[model samples]
Target: MSDAATPELRRLTTYPVKSLDPQDHDSVAVEHGTLAGDREYAMVAKPPDADHDPTTASVGGQGEYVNGKRTAAVHRLRSSLDREAGVLTLREEGGDETRTFSLDDPDALNDYLSDYFDEPVSVRHEPRGGYPDDREFDGPTLVSTATLREVASWFDMTLDSARRRFRANLEVGGVPAFWEDRLFADHGEAVAFRIGDVELLGCNPCRRCVVPSRDPDTGEETPGFRETFLRERERTLPEWVDSDRFEGNFRLMVNTRISESEWGQRLSVGDGVELLGTRQL
Candidate 1:
């Protein structure tokens, strides 16, 4: 499809903290490789015995890392960030009690979270970038609603469920199911895809993790469809689709970093997307 015919930016989701409720916005500020105020802070685990700083602990391995994945109890919780006041509001979905405090107050936040989650944790902030799951704190990930709809077909639930489960920063519409996979180097020349007015590079396919199996809202464990899908021996994929970028047969979503243009710019929900020219790499 031509740039003019490309999909529209359907939605924008920002996570102030890792494994917390996402804030939906119509427009957002993008700066220094991350959405402004997105994943600005996170409650990192402080294990009793750890060599390095607990906040720097790797999440996947047996490091001093903890979040909703470590405890489903955390997923039942929701959070809201007041950037101007530097206050964070935490509440339960089906409850009335709400905790509000300064994002800088890690001690108080830690105590509250420890009491509720029954695990020692400390809150930390990243000014340049938020605490991301990617290798380096890149930026917001873009996923297509059409892709969500197709992936949902592999399960019994609705596409809305996948959206909640996948937890993409940006959801696009009016595009094919796997158009994102072909944006860069699915074949031949590498094309640079533009979001709003930004040309994206550092494209990477997000590998599957156990987090997808956990409910984003309730934090309940499911049948692990994402895990199963990755392990499938055979896949009837498209010809232009880049299978080499994926690993473990279960990869989904494209993570892009380094916007060529549109630096210090604002990306809106209704912004049109297109490809300007061939990307060198």
Candidate 2:
């Protein structure tokens, strides 16, 4: 593949728990829809306002799924899981103290997390479930670093990778700006994600939410991120497309799922991204 056709993976990040600190890796194993340990365990929680509308947030408990979007305080917590040992640890930033729990025990895990998050939470993991945003195992998420820098420039903010709200399993380098958006986000085009011996379908553009505006390190919200993103996208939106027909949000990434012949493959940072087809305008 030509240089433009090949994008290089720069980082592989996994979130063992949804909406917690990212676990950075030089290489990771990709399954049907997720990295091996990514979001394997998420804090099942109730709504901030369960008393008003119990049905909408009820998962047989007071509320339902809790995440950074509803509770930004989660952004303050960092998580690490020892899959082999079934141990998960949550640590606060700038503090040496840590809270450790065993996934083997459900009761204690929920109790400990409930207190720490200042909300009633039940620590839950679907042993057979791959806890990705696309529950259907549609794909893994990818965000380009070049695209990150572009967004940063729009807001006149520091180009700090840590500040990037878009959580992507694979962060890539090379390719022109917004290449992924064209191939998938804007047009929902299918492309080949090949690296080493693995193949994934660049299925769809990931939808966005308020979660990305909050800083994962401090829980502080960045203003104008959405506005800037929408403006930038408007510049690139195809004239033929109905504005409302597009699937993803103003700030979004592509979802890539493992394709046939490579159900479980190990992916490394240096993996080369080879686009198989043309990008729609």
Candidate 3:
């Protein structure tokens, strides 16, 4: 294939637990509607005790998911997962102590996280497809390497930091900035694309949340990060990008859904990506 017809998959990242540090993989299977291990485990909040401070605000409130979007405190916790061993290790930024726990022990894990957050919490596991942000299009998220570089330059941050902030599942190289925009069309439509042998339908530009505005390591918010990003994103938007699907400027990567036939397909780094055109959603 010509260079323009095939972009190389430069990286594959998955989050074993939602809103935690990402884990890189050379290859992974497409299970259910998403990458096999992506967001397979998530921490959910439990009811607060009677002594709990009522004045304090929890974005999602009790009985909801605890994530970076709900609270910046989620950023303070760093996670590393050992898939084969089924163990998870968590550490706080700027802290010397690190704790490891077995994935099989939900009570212990929940207690540790609950203590860490100073609230009642529990671990939820869904090995089928995990807790994806966009359930309608639960496939892996896609972004171009050049797009990440461009975004990093705008914030004066490193590429690695930008990657952490965006948390896309697939990164394609050998393409210009915002090249992934071509993967989607107008609203109610989808763009068909293939990576290796797997096919996916790019539904729309991902609607971003508050998580991207803070430092991935620290819970501190960046001054004017969202404002600056919105301004830059609109100014740099490619002409071919379908603006109809973009209700606002708070969008970045492409959210996609997989075909049942493509389930169990293997995707690896260096896989060639090809666009197969668009269709009505």
**Which regions of candidate 3 are displaced past 4 Å?**
1-6, 47-62
Candidate 3 global lDDT: 0.86
Task: Output the lDDT of residue 54, model 1.
Answer: 37
CA RMSD for every model?
3.5, 4.8, 4.1
**RMSD, candidate 1, Å:** 3.5
Clashes of 1: 2
**What ranges in model 2 sit over 4 Å off?**
1-5, 46-63, 94-96, 127-129, 161-164, 185-189, 236-249, 278-281
Decide which is better by TM-score, 1 or 3. 3
Return the lDDT, model 2, position 262.
Answer: 75
Model 3 per-residue lDDT tens digits across residues 45-100: 87433223211322444356789877899999988999889899999998999999
Per-residue accuracy of model 2 over 1-281 as CA lDDT, tens digit each: 23445688887888777777677889777664467777776676743223433223435545556677677878777777887898888788778988888888767767777887777777556443356777543456887787777766776666564334777888778765566664442344455657666776665666778877667677788887677678887776445433332554464677766654675678898888776653332
Q: Across residues 106-125, which tens digit of lDDT does each residue of candidate 1 receive? A: 56777888777787666767
Error of 3 at 113 (Å): 0.7
Q: After superposition, how far is residue 186 of candidate 2 from its true place, in Å?
A: 8.8
Clashes of each: 2, 5, 0
Worst 10 residues of 1 by lDDT: 47-56
lDDT of model 1, residue 211: 67
